[model samples]
Target: MELKNKDNNSNSGNKQINAMTEGNPVRLILVFAFPMLVGNVFQQLYNMVDSIVVGNYVGKIALAAVGTGFPLIFMMASLFIGLGIGATILIAQYVGAGDIENVKKTCQTIYTAMILGAIPISILGLFLCEPILNLINTPADTLPMAKQYMMIIFAGLLGAIGYNMNTGILQGFGDSKSSLLFLVIATGINIALDLLFVVVFGWGVAGVAIATIIAQAFSWIFGLVYMRKKYEVLNFQILKFYFNRDIFVKILKLGLPTGIQQMLFSIGIMSIQSLVNSYGSDFIAGFNAANKIDMFAFMPIQSFSNAVTTYTGQNIGAGRMDRVHSGTVAAVTMSVIVCLLALVIIPLGPPLLGLFNSDSAVIESGMIYLKNVMPLYVLLAIVFVINAVVRGAGESVVPMIGAIVTLWLGRIPSAYYIAYNFGKEYMFYSYGIGWFFWLMITGPYYLSGKWKTKSQKLIRQ
Candidate 1:
């Protein structure tokens, strides 16, 4: 096969980027991942602002309410999101292979699935909100607020579903720049509305929910308009979409494991959150604040991991498996460089924690949590990038199994046992311990070169 250049695939005027299928592996991956990195920063701010505004303007209890509801929200969102990940990988392969018709059909099929899937899930999600929160052992004082916050957010399920699908579409095509632009637009709106609704009007927790829903609405609308202007291939007729078993099976084969994996991952986080709730509101508030900050620090690794997916998927689709090893090396190098930024940022943990709340105890407790986890970020980066590489090779089960073991067997149990017998600080240590376990499992598998053959059997099936 001849090595293809970006000009062949990219639209005129360079409105879209085509990094993964061509260019120097290191530079291509970095340039491709940069927009995703920035977009994720703004996206993380969606959660970060919820805590900051609610904490400062309303109270710690309000902040705790927002915190308490997070894992639950993700638990619901990750189900569809897991499927979206499968769609992204498949689309990347189709795009790289230059199978234009299949790409169009797959995108329409996904939108069909989204439209059908969103209705029942939203209904089920809305109905089960309080019961699930109760099952998680949400504190009595915070129960009403958690219920309120969750209900408002889930009510806009269509918007959230639409927005994520749009982002995944751009991601599959190697157009991270357009996605970043929409996210910046959404984030600006979100922050402005958060201040107006929460601070000026005093709507409290509900204001945060309204702002997020509205921001997501903007993102989805903007994404649709962008796709219309730039990518002619993706603008398929939705009305003509019919269920094709082969395409559906192709997507589900890769998607289900990841969906289940993400759902289970959320369950694991919720499990640990339940344990955290047992420690009382201060611990919950502190952990919540600290968790928000921790997400910002970790987004780069997560962003680069997505790069590994697109990079690996496209190269494999193009029959350029030879490029993968060097690309993986580039990803790891970039991830390490990003994670090392924590060393400078973590030491000022006190003043940083002060941004959320003035309470000395909240700051101290949050600092301890951040200190334990932030410096060890590089370990998670290694694990994330490798799993992404393997998964993108069309073997999603490998990472799914790793997530099950790490989250269920290692992290959750350790967090529970440590918090119960030892104390809160020891529970924070469970994260590093779990990442080490994940690295041990996935690292050697990547080195063995067995996944290449395994993916051949899977992808062709």
Candidate 2:
């Protein structure tokens, strides 16, 4: 009878098993990614909707104003986003290792971020808005509207910082679903407000900007609530309004590369936008529409990359090197599948482009742009997935350096040369050529197993 007592009474075993299978990895990836996909769609929708509203209601010049200002705003926003990336990575490692104390401390870094990153950018957005606009060579007709829109959006910089910080914290804790939910709610509100204010109320660009700021504020609130209620480790009581030097330095070290990468990437896009401006409004509108469509196709890749980064970060911290390797393989496989599907849908580019504008000229131009760029999705997917893996492994510096060098030295120079020396029509090649070149450069660095080695050493240090 005593020999029959074979059942294990330990709850630790059960907990470990549950943790291992919390959600099927594939299912978890999809669940985490779907909301982001929807949010991204809505994000693109708002921008596209803004263009449609303004182009049809206000005028093409206003539409161009909104479109041109996007890259500039993105450049400014990239700094905060970069800092958020740093926070996410550090939080993810702590989460993976099951270290609650560090997670709470990491959360406090948001205060540091507010002081060191957000406040400075917000001030720049307010005071330097007009001068920056002029420096970017904004057209005379569009300058006033652009300045109006930029100032209003920048006025709500605190909200943007809140959104970024909260999302990063949630993502680090393996709760991407909450972040996605907030995005969905915010995006829906944004669209409704956009229509009510811009179309019915005749508020123009300022209305659209106001709508976005309000929506972002709501997202930040929801994110805060979710963290307080759901995340057991994130303690609001410990949050200080002042900075912590050690935490600040750690956050900056991890985040600075990502921020620089984003800044440089935006700079590269601005450079291209400058070139497009020379081609006239038709090309600019077409380019903007095409870029929106590209964002849709790119959303899945971005989502997967985010998931992989978190997954890899946690596993690396847990010393589960086997899982880390497996997770990477899974991520790359998923990315390839998505990219392949995109290749089949590439021919539908014209139809998608037409949704943004019925103008035959714009549609034709967008079609040309998409058709030329679509086949490169496979390459892009590989590049993105690998970059995420690198970032997750805490080898951000190499990737950041590669991106800067490729974008500035390879892409920008080639773009200038092709557009000016070869022919304006050759500008599209610059995009493909840059991706192809960087893929080649990055592939070896990744394959050499350097990132994995470097990451192991980093964790030890």
Candidate 3:
């Protein structure tokens, strides 16, 4: 049963939610994405701090240990993240349509689902921690620490899930700034705790993990208070839980494919991680450090992509196909421009890698990875922007199919073959290859106008 809204304010009266259904597409997308971009950067910074503190203080092995667990953690959390994506789209649509009640229901539904879903995922992750590490061929020296780190992360899975779901809800409402503020709080707390725990207390990998979860839990709690006070529509009692079956089903239908895509993508990365692990802990740490550097290059485009998702969702919900197209162009252009700007990172790779770890071999390995990947970021930008536009229009299955084709056919197999036959240095080229294939899929789909029709159906349904 759908719950009744006791509040009398209509969607427009709820000033907290921005209506992207109007305004200039470029300006709106830029405005919307900036906070999200900063937030992503902060999130990545804390992640880098994790690597830096561990690599510098604990050892290269600890860096590799944390790195090894990341793909596995993401794989486990992917489903809920997907559901959050679904809820964001639903809420965006409802907000656009002035269906404030459904918007509230979506926020409530996804929150409840995330809280409930975290339990089994936590248990499963705990049980599989060691076994999964073994399966991934984690370096024996790193495995125990990796297992410990992962177990702590899993045990506090609700914090991460809840925090992300909270961000998704805010993003849906076109309120990206609040999410950024939350991330700022988390990042500050996390960095301080990381130094205090690992550097001061000598807790090693365990300290970093504990600091991370505490920060996330704190951020999630702060978001709740912030949202409740700032937005009446978002004010809901956490203790009183309910699920609107129809909204959940809608979320599941949209989110399941994206979840599967995330799982497959994570699995592909895990396979690549195993191959890197075969080279031992130094290479793993280098790869991890390089990945962090790469995210800085990638984050702007990614932020624009996310911005367009909400942009396209809200515009399409308002029956503005033209705005969707214009937004896509604006987002794509902005992303490519940022990608070009980010190419500056390639020349600075060695120093960047050195910041994470002082070892020469680690720096060399990271530079090799960076040189191979950074130049081709324009392709990734195009792929991500177009893909987000498709997803925003509620055509998630196509993007999922793109992931399957790209990963199975383009990235993973190519990575293994190139690494084994040519050399490990060539493995990063597979990222560009996969991204090219993704663009091939999503670009054509976007041009076909099929996604707009699908969006209409989704909105109507």
Candidate 4:
């Protein structure tokens, strides 16, 4: 009866939860993806709200300070998220196999592992933030505020890390709705706090960081309560929790590449950011505004990528390769539609950049970035959609290689060499060149049907 009530709350009367492993390919992917899309948008908006408030009120310096620290923050943050994705893939497979006990064990293990890991990470982040900022040649004007912002965010690392891991666990079981609900609640709270701390309290950059931390804490806490209430299989017993060496080993093997890929990706961006920093604050501010806008363009593909990940994870776990194939086709179609829709914002780019910061130079620079990158989003869309299938098959290393190689080998080298000799505008084109080669390298692997063999063998494990 309790489980029945939970089902009713989530699925409602006529509408049932979209089960990825057992439905029409296109419809299932869309239904499963909608809530995630909304959640991601809200997440991005919450980030945007920080810039909007800070840029409009605290000034561009504050905005620049916040923007400067983010890539560094995300570098570490993505490590945990990638680790969760590893857990998600394994859990999805276990759930698909109807191994309820193992699913519970996996959940407990991930929870325990992350909790143990967060403390050291948080401390290290706080200690490292300043040194790294200095290394990036962060301007003296912004350094103090940037350190303040980055440290506070680190102090609350548990909330951010835990929340993402919970989202991953839920997604693994095809429960996107709950994570969306939690995100909605958190984002609403975040927006309200943004106004209170930044405007009402005059806390500036620190205020936004505080708001984000509290909001993340709310989501993680609420996620725990919900899981305990709804899932008998999700109950966390301290005494029952022991190191599952086998599960931990599996999670690391499949997921470490993802974590490495993201860390290296962020490192590559940091490398570029170090160069961007040398140009001065106006350029940094403009890069931030353009990146904020770029998130809107990229978020859809990310949403679809996540949907495909969950879809492929669940279906492959259920031994439904046919569903995986059809779903990939549908995901690619959805991705193209989203990429086209994002283009509408391109012509509106100048005004949007201006909204973030009214400086003429900042506006013009940001517009250049949007115009160059946004049009080529379709190429990016193709790589993301196809990679989703590859990752869901637990062939994470393959895509990870494709990503790191493209960034370090292609994007980084080209960006630096071009900027050093010719100019920066040409450097932006390297973004496309990188994606094109990435697609060329990875797209064929997907078509070759190698991942299908890997997925088939995974079931036997």
Estimate the Cα RMSD of every predicted model relative to the unseen true structure.
Answer: 2.8, 5.1, 2.5, 3.7
Error of 1 at 80 (Å): 1.4
As a TM-score, model 1 comes out at 0.94
lDDT tens digits, residues 127-206, model 2? 87787777766767778998898888888877777887887877776666677778778878888898899899999989
Q: What is the C-alpha lDDT of each candidate?
A: 0.82, 0.73, 0.88, 0.83
lDDT-sorted candidate list, best first: 3, 4, 1, 2
Overall local distance difference test of candidate 2: 0.73
Candidate 1 lDDT tens digits, 1-461 = 22223345533433353647777998878887899999999988877888899999988878889989878778787767877888888877766675656666677888888878887887777888899888888888888988999998888877888888887877888878888888899899999999999999999999999999999888887788778677776666555656666777888877889888988998888888888788777778888988888887788888888988988888888788999999999999889988887677677777877788878888878987887788788889898999989978888888889888888878888888888798887778889888888888889888988789744544455
For candidate 4, the per-residue lDDT at 319 reads 80
Model 3 residue pairs with clashes: none
lDDT of 3: 0.88
List where candidate 3 sits over 4 angstroms from the true fold: 1-13
**Model 4: worst 10 consecutive residues (lDDT sum):** 1-10
Better of 2 and 4 by TM-score: 4
Model 1 accuracy (lDDT, Cα): 0.82
Best of the two (3, 4) by lDDT:
3
Backbone clashes in candidate 1 total 0
TM-score of each: 0.94, 0.90, 0.97, 0.94
| Clashing residue pairs in candidate 2 (N, C-alpha, C atoms within 3 angstroms) | none
